[model samples]
Target: MKKFNFLGFRFLFRVERENRDDVQVYSDTYQLKDRMVYFLVFLMIISLSSQLGNIFQRNKYIDKDIIKENIYAPRDVKYKDVLKREAIIKDIVEESEKKYIYLPEIGKKYSRGLNEFYDEILQIKEKKIKNFDYDFFEENYKLKIAPEIVDGVLDLSKREINSQRKDLMEILDKVYSHGIREGETFITTMAGKDFKDKELSNIEFKVLDIFTFPNYVYDRERTKFEIKKRVDGIEDQYTTVKAGELVLKKGELLDKEKIQVLNALGIYSFAETVLRFSVTGIYLITVSVIAYNIVTTKFKKELSNKNIYGATFLVFALLFFIFRFFGKDYLYLIPFETGFFLLQILVNSAYAFYFGIIALIYITPMINYDMVYFVITLLTILFATRFLGSVKTRVQFINLGIQLAIVKLIIYFSITFLTFGVSETVLLDSTKIILAGIFSGVLTLAIVPYLERSFNILSSFKLLELGDLSNPLLRDLSVKTPGTFYHSMMVAAVSEAAAEAIGADPIFTRVASYYHDIGKMKRPKFYVENQEGGENPHDKISPFLSALVILAHTKDGFEMAKKYKVPREIRDIMLEHHGTTFLAYFYNKAKSLDENVREDDFRYSGPKPKTKESAIIMLADSIEAAVRSIEHKTYNNIEEMIRKIIFNKLEDGQLKDADLTFKDIETIIKVFTKTIIGIHHVRIKYPGQEKESEENKTDEN
Candidate 1:
């Protein structure tokens, strides 16, 4: 058989294999790929959703037919027509040898003259149209007309001379008279010459074509159609006209019908009144990511929850909907850090770093893009990360708030100076920034403490303080009953270190250890430290009475602690540490005397410490005291004592209620052995060392 040591090859090999088996090795490369896929899918979904939203909004405009191309009209006439008009022309022709009128020359000259006449008419008509006015129709004709085409007149005379005839004339007038007429014929004309000075000759006119001349009477019925076409045209040209000269002056509003027409035409849709703010979810995720980084650096462990993803989604959704509710005025309610900072303090600050980016995203819609909120939120997380490790009290939390406020002020003033130029009014904005900081501070002050107490978060500073043996309860023990006090301090050190090593709450272990022996305070004389002159007081009392006295201390300490306003946590440790275990000294003494004493009579009544920390403290307190009783202490002697004590407690079923494992108890034993051995380790004394001087004893006396 092989004698195995932990350092032996076989043992080391087994241990190494176990460690390898325990380690979960995952490929981060795959994780990155998964994240990339998720991000792409997310972006695709969001982009597609936004596009769908845009399509829905645009559908309203499309229903009006304003987006159709062929339904609109031109705004102005061509320069060629303007020049052709105001022309005076004449033609000369030779006559053949004949006494009567010559038909051959008349044929050419007559064609030219007729062309000149049409040209002059078109010129005059086009000139009139250059200064065309639509206000007269809107102000007066629109009211008089019945939204139906009467004659070419847009004939406002509601009592049409004959409705059919009016319709026919309106159609004919729109085709010929309203539009330019075009033809090709030779003509010689002087620019801007008087008609009287020019010979009668051919003239050319390009008649403008009025494609559709539905009158104002028909405007109401055809408005949908006409304005659809008109809007298409107007929008294409983007006409800008002064409202005063157009139809309504600044103070005057259009009649309901005209307003309807304008709406149908999408007049305001194209107005610059539609503002789009750049609110993004990515920026929010960035904040959450930053928070995660900062806090992970602080915690140095994988967070309890993958809160980076959780908080990003939460913040993104919150800000997205927040802007939707408040529109653009969400600035005054920027609690951007509230969710983020609270999450950091409660769970992990790594989660908070990412929330900084989330804050930016959530707040982007509410604040000006160039405002300091983004930088301020980031700096707040960075600065606050240092405090994350040790933040325990409300005062520390308040100080954190102050630090955050200062950061916000610095960022605000810096950004203001950068963006607002060098104006002194920036001082006012800085003041507002400072006020914002103050508000954030107040908000944190109100929230952090409640969360800590409710959630049982243990900060490092809290753990450190709890580990101190100088704490009031432990100090009371040291003064009143030194043996139990010393035992409790040793248990506290052992239990706290073990708890920390196993990733349990060290503060709970340390604090619970300090109060576990509070029950011993009642029978101080029975305890060794308070027993003077090596007197065994327990020998004088009956075993049952001594057992009763021993058992009563658990309850007595509890009542005393409560009466004195000791924290509930300490009281819990005091009540549960013994856990109804038998008063072994009295139980054995009784058994030797009577041989029939009931074991039940010797048990201590208890509620028992329910938590892991309390249970560990219970074992440590018992183990430390039992090991100290050994007269000839060796590593082997201490180990046997630890084994016996643990076995006795286990056999008595005192540990049944606790959820501790055999493995955990073995670890506890190792910690106990190491602590006891260190305390009892040998050291050489200086040669010729002497006893205390007589003067020292006289001073003590």
Candidate 2:
């Protein structure tokens, strides 16, 4: 140790190996290497996390050119060509061109033609019958109008009929003799009457050629329906794609049929591979950076510890793994909030909040980018930090756990009800959310003990456990040294009160006080508190030797604390209980024995009180012993004694490193005075004056 004097203040520069528990140490060489390792590990996780989003992504659409060039039927895949058959049938029906073959306009035109032909034929027949019958029969002999003619001829009919109609439709192919009407037939009713046989003269068989051909042919609509029926009857048309055949060759065009076949085979295209890789890379990089920044900066303290950072990494890995495997379907089973709460207990609330956000970033994308998980986890973390600040006892943890769980359940329920509404799925999902909330709360409680024990991390819960009376060191102190135990109890009572009055950790002070004087258990009778039968061991010892024995207790207590595995905070308090102050009684005794005795020889070897609780413990230890030896136990006397003890420690600079203010000291003095007076107050009973009181009462009567 080297002393550096600054102005009038002397500063001791201590160079020693200290316990690296809460503090961050700086080393020059490998610090950059450590940071790089963290960054590289984070990058690896980010790269792998990309594949989690790939789990549910749809395959990309292939370019027609690429599909034609690269794809093949690696294995036989068969499926139905659901649209090909129906499509072929439709094409066949549509390909057959419709034929309109409507009849020509014949209702009025053919009726007029026939009537004119009939008049002309009748005139010719009249001329032949009346005047030229001799010449017409003699020259031609083709006017074959005979009685009951069967092989009739239109040889005598005029030329130049409707030539196009006759040529195209063969309208004049109808057989008739010379002159005819609707009532006459070519054979029977031509030269005679019906069956009565009475028209042999008035209708001389030459005028039956002209007849009306109706243009009111088959109804056009009826004809169309008939033609459609005929076409529909020919429906055997088909197009087939045989199984295990080249439905779509690698270079073939991607028509509808080809596309159908490819889809049926369940083949993914090259475009999908590129797309999956791209998307995975994007999501991984983005989320990894965000997660890294948040956790590193927010949880820097906890991460300073290798075990803590390892645990945090484990949390991230577990979350990502669950998202990759189970996805958001079973989000209830994932202990997301538990990890956040654990970090809060292990570190700080600010760090835990950002750590929770990091969890959100990592898991949200991996699990389908679901806001439900993010929102629920955020709410649970907020509630945990707000309500479960520092859990001391297991019962306190349970109470807070239940409260946090209930509040988380309400938040989850409200979110689900508002988003999904009331339904069967909603009910089931809400139940899962509630279960997850409670499960995470219970998990946080269960894992805390293992974390504390395995890492030797001091927490409020550990302090509460140390405060238990059943610890081996405290138990041994009670059984091995009763007088010292009682004195320690008085110190602990006032120390706890004073620590609480000034907003320090009271339970920690009490536990530290219980074990502070554990060195006295080694030599019980040497100290005045443990002396029995009024014997004093220091009577036979020199002042220098007695001071050596008394000063050795601090060292002994430090060793016992190590053997019992006490926390650094408790061990520090045990060592610093006396501070580096000169024991005045022993120093005066040594001075009287030798004129050249130096005060440094009687001073206790100490690091001084370095914390508020330690400083209060030092004062309480001194004040408790001083009050016990006082002749008068009056309130004024006790207050005076306690104030002097505190003022003396302050004047001696023992409380230099403590974070106590003037206000805190005043509060400590008031609390210590109240506690001491309560313990050693005087009674009003008078044993000697009782007889005088009875005689005075009788005289008054």
Candidate 3:
């Protein structure tokens, strides 16, 4: 079991060696399980950070708290003042007048009942029923006419009773026509006022009182309808807050009025809090998912999950805290392009552009989704990613900062002029935006080195630095093994040209080639190139031993590279440049001695060239050595040699895993042929050299 720590996180790997001769090492299933656990842990951290941001945003304001500082609105918001609107509606409803409807049928109904009672009395009298039960009249007419009244009515003559009934009916009609209202004593007053002039007996008055009924009824539905109409007619009470408008003054008390205004602005409500949390969670998860898909699909090899997740986590956390403390007004001060620049330098430019856009979108909500800010930041990120490609020195970053500031000012002024017509406010904001761009580049320059070290990333800046010949490892190679160093220089030149032709990283290829043979420094004379016409070290040793020594160099070189802390890409090139191609000289020599010798024993342990640059280096290394060994240096001979070497490498399956197309291989071949021919061009012999060569040849004959 081996444990490795990266960026404060520990990873455990269980190594299993099946055979010592094989180059590949196997790991147990724990590696996959550990990766999943790491992923889950990262997800949990992201979720928790998002929730913390949500909590901060949701509880940023409180009711009745003293305003410590002025708070400006994030955007223009027109909110209905719920408390004020309700009070207005209440006042309007209360002031609304009540309504009533008249019922004319009440007068007719009372007259009909009185006429029936009279007819019943007449019938009783017509039957000549003396001493008959007066209760019959009460029961039949549904009335409580007294016995005395009944007797009075019966004792009267027919003409007198008819006249009295007619008089009472006229009085009742007059009283009923004047609409009586329930819960009012106007009935008695009205009857007395109209009948005082008439000579009405007590019985007639009592009968008129009994027959009277209230006809005016309150219209509850209609009254409610009118009140509702009035309330609806009242305009809603709305309070508007413009963007950047101060909601509260420093040291002022947040009274009920201010609290109500804040509530209207969505500052203090349970539903609003929940909505903010929901939006934050959804946005974080969606962005994380999209980033995961992009990184895994496009940048899996160039970027590690740790670097991606770690960088994203920091950016998200930084944004959340900035918004939480300073609010959206200061959002432009954040150097968002710092992250983009780091990604561009550490990863691919295209990846930086894509992830930068995602980050810009995520922060747009903080600025209240202002498209102006979004567009400005988007163009800034585009400029940063595009123009800041392959930063070679710290001075370039400073220049980039100045350039970005200028570009940002130009873009801001252009957009503001077209849309907002160049106001004073726009001019002021342009200053802030320009500073943001400059600050981003400065911040990127400051943080890139730390990030490179922390994440162990090999950016182009580091590549250029590593390519310097004054580097300690390269210096050591030159001092210890000058022949191998010279050979490496030639290989680097050819490989760099081929890489440029194929759109690969020429600097990385050149740097990797410079350090590829650092292992030969361990025993310089054992290799033929460094012998310098001295006795061959391989003459005393068996061919198998020589093959072992040669094969051991790739592994030794990988270890030396690790000791010197070279980048992983360079270390990989060191190990893969030789691939598994057979050492034909050693293998043939061993086979001539013993037919039982195995071909695999003479091959270098290799995982094959897995990248276009590594494959080009492999071809260049072989082609350079083969051409240098040629006695007759001709263009056709060099071309034939390069073609044959590439064909042999292809047939040997050394490039099976390399990401090279057939067209790329052809281009590489032309580049190598031309470079090799230039390096080994035919030279005109001087007179002293020609006489020396002829005398030497004559002595030899």
Q: Which residue segments of model 1 deviate by more than 4 Å?
A: 1-387, 392-399, 402-475, 593-596, 647-653, 661-663, 682-701
Tell me each candidate's RMSD, in Å, in order. 24.0, 19.8, 14.6
User: Model 2, which residues run further than 4 Å from truth?
Assistant: 1-48, 51-59, 62-329, 347-354, 395-405, 422-425, 591-598, 682-701
- Model 2 local distance difference test score: 0.65
Over 577-603, each residue of candidate 1 has an lDDT whose tens digit, in order, gives 888877777888888989989988887
List TM-scores for all candidates, in order: 0.46, 0.58, 0.62
Residues 1-701 of candidate 2: C-alpha lDDT, one tens digit per residue: 99888899999888898565433445422343365357536645654554434335343234353333544453333234556546654666667444333334433444344444334444554465332233433243334334232112222334422332233122222322122333334454333523232232222232323233322233456646755675555433223333345555445555555666555444334555445557756766766666656555554546666666565666566656666666544655565677777776666677678767666765664554456667766776776777666665566655665566567567767876665445555465567656665676677778888877676666667777787788888889989898999998999999999988888878789988998999888888889888866879899999899999998898898898888888777888878989898889999989898999988888888889988999999999999989988996766678888889888888999998997899999999889888988888654336756578688989999
Give the worst 10-residue stretch by lDDT in candidate 3: 21-30
What's the lDDT of the predicted structure labeled candidate 1? 0.53
Q: Model 1 misses residue 498 by how many Å?
A: 1.2
Ranking by TM-score: 3, 2, 1
Q: What is candidate 3's lDDT per residue for 190-294, written digit by digit as tens?
A: 644655677777777676666676677778899899888777776656666778898888888777778777765556545566676677667756766675566
What local lDDT score does residue 321 receive in model 2, on the 0 to 100 scale? 66
Compared with the true structure, all predictions reach lDDT values of 0.53, 0.65, 0.75
Q: Following a full C-alpha superposition, what root-mean-square deviation does model 2 have from the true structure?
A: 19.8
